[model samples]
Target: DTTVKQNPRYKLARVGKPVNLICSQTMNHDTMYWYQKKPNQAPKLLLFYYDKILNREADTFEKFQSSRPNNSFCSLYIGSAGLEYSAMYLCASSRDGPETLYFGSGTRLTVL
Candidate 1:
């Protein structure tokens, strides 16, 4: 199959809590796309092939996947989204890092 896949295609996460997401490729495809979508909200861009694979579709395309004129972000904001809002904030990705790096009390994203 030429399909890119991520496990638990559908997930359940607490509104303000954390969730575990597992991704796998049956074909071991070259790339995988992780999309976070909310009810009635358009699919938001995540990242890209990340290995510098260029987009040949329109020639100058991106996101992770992007194209917007959305009216969802207000001054307070949600008149929609913008091309500038296409990434994960406070996210870290490491595969070959030191395992002894966790010596902290912890991390918590406080919303107030």
Candidate 2:
């Protein structure tokens, strides 16, 4: 596989509840990323895993959290869902830093 998978193509959460999204890739890529996209705005990088290393965007460090359980799987977790978090969650993979990313179709999250 090109190396990336996300579950629940779509999700709806109540405000203030926790939310978790899953992703996987088979390419054995060491670097995987998660981004949040909204209408009229650029996809914002949230966090990523470089092998066992984890990096979160400076501005988003506190807004989002992620973990890579293994080379083939990763997940993003939001402690408290909010309307502002309603957006498409994109999972991507790259061999290393600044490389082209292979993205999943994306998981659309809606907060109510």
Candidate 2 residue-wise lDDT, 6-38, digit = tens: 998999999999999999999888888899999
In candidate 1, where is summed lDDT lowest over 10 consecutive residues? 69-78
RMSD of each: 15.6, 1.2
Off by over 4 Å in 1: 49-112
Residue 101 in candidate 1 has what lDDT? 13
lDDT of 2: 0.91
Best by lDDT: 2
State TM-scores per candidate: 0.33, 0.94
Q: Pick the candidate with the highest TM-score.
A: 2
Local accuracy by lDDT, each model: 0.28, 0.91
